[model samples]
Target: MSTIDAQTDSDATDVASRSNYELIIEPRKGLQLFDWKELVAYRDLFRFLIWRQIKVRYAQSAIGIGWAIIQPLFSMLVFTIIFGNLAKVDSDGAPYALFSLAALLPWTYFSNAITDGVQSLVSEANMLRKIYFPRLMLPLSAVAAKLVDFGIAAVMMVVMMIVFQYPPSIQIVALPLAIIVMLITASGVSVWLTALAVQYRDIKHGMNFLVQLLMYASPVVYAASIIPEKYRLLYAINPMVGVIESFRAAILGTTSIPWDLLGVGFLSGTILLITGLAFFRSKEKIFADVA
Candidate 1:
């Protein structure tokens, strides 16, 4: 009986030790570095989010993806009438319509990225409350979804350029750099804005107003040359200045690639990306709680 009692006591202790385990998961206390390994592990989730955004974007709509082509096309027409015809905005000797369309392509992508991204976190509040996934995925997927729209708009651009009798020059090689800068700027701004919008809620409402204000600040409808030469470098800090101007130079193929503008814009975009990531990570902890 004593041997049996000793064995029973030992068995109870073993089971108790195994059952009394603790696991804690939360955002870190100090500097919060992104966990790349964990994100890679969640790649499937990221891809699914991206696809879901693209599908749901036009699910119940009649025009479907035609909305993509219509947005910039209508904006270009409006700009041509107002700025190109009325104001006589310079177009670097190309048709004003094509010039504005080029800038509008990237600008539209940026605008859509911000408009959707700022809402990404707040819109998914239920998922945030119920599940544990990388919150960064929300904004990233939002930005990526707009690329499909950009692609459709770009095809329209190609057709218009051909109709206008404009052809791209060898300088088209630099087009990819312009696009990369646009993506960097969009991602950085989206991340920062989305992070803040999730917490404050007011940022969500003001995003459209902010984007409208920013469009005028960029070279979307007007040429950067309208600005005094002395202010070019200062103005290039806008990031989109380099992006839009570079797109024109590359796509329109009239001007040589603006290496100087590209350098300043790329540097500014890089700084924005780094600082935005830092801010997003710092605020990551409060998202679940406040959200």
Candidate 2:
């Protein structure tokens, strides 16, 4: 081979070596889209994020996990006294405490999930600015971590059921559906608010009032049957109305599973979730900047 040709070949090899190790960091092209597959691929990171939240939740607490049962348990007591006794609200023939608790358990989960999930990104601004993971994980994991609280509270529920002699009926088979509805609804609202929260901080302040209004709007303290039949269908559109009522039927067997409510709630939840995901994806590009 000619000397010049040999020299040129070495130069080409050197350039090829440099090219092999090069990494081009550039902006993502065009409009961003939610990558569902990327989320699945990062499942380990998601689990870790959930665990990290769980640790942070109980790290400095004295009662620790007991705090989970406290809220619903106390709420049940208050509602039992106010609605069950004072106003004489009907509990579908179920004991008022059991009646209120069944609703409180799922309701508490939904409320806490939204409260935590909405503020998750803002609370973790440093992490948001420093790293690249699925931004959805922040809200998603915040929701998941609350499952720990839900589980602890559920055990307390089993004890209450035993004391009250309220064995869940065969309709308990439908309880999973109620849980799914709760998750879908909470996640949807949280994602939408978390996305918007990165832009507008006012949501956090109004959230508690909104949650209280939602609780009362549903049959949490009263009977769904008491609502004029004409408005029941529209009332079920609130998402919690169906799930809260379903929790009662599935657990207390006070009434047949309200398939209509489930159908309505599930449909509304799906729309909220799909639209929320779209909004989150569109605004994702600005999260690090705003957060």
User: Residue-wise lDDT of candidate 2 within 129-221, one digit each (tens)?
Assistant: 998989999999998899999999899989999998778899999999999999999999999999988899999888999899888898889
**What's model 2's lDDT at 149?**
92
| Candidate 1 residue runs with Cα over 4 Å from true position | 1-20, 26-32
* TM-score of predicted structure 1: 0.92
Q: Candidate 1 at 115: error in angstroms?
A: 1.1
Per-residue alpha-carbon lDDT of candidate 1 for residues 1-291, written as tens digits (9 for 90 to 100): 699999999999999999999988754677555779879999999999999999999999999999999999999999999999999988988899999999999999999997998899998889988988989999989999999999999999999988988887778888899999999999999999988988888898898789999999999998888889898899999889999999999988657777877889999998988888888888887888887
Give the distance in Å from residue 88's predicted Cα in candidate 1 to where it truly belongs. Answer: 0.9
Clashing pairs in 2: none
Quick one: best lDDT, which candidate? 2
lDDT of 1 at 21: 92
- Alpha-carbon RMSD of each model: 3.1, 3.3
- Computed on alpha carbons, the lDDT of every model, listed in order, comes to 0.90, 0.91
In model 2, the runs with Cα more than 4 Å from the true position are 1-16, 19-33
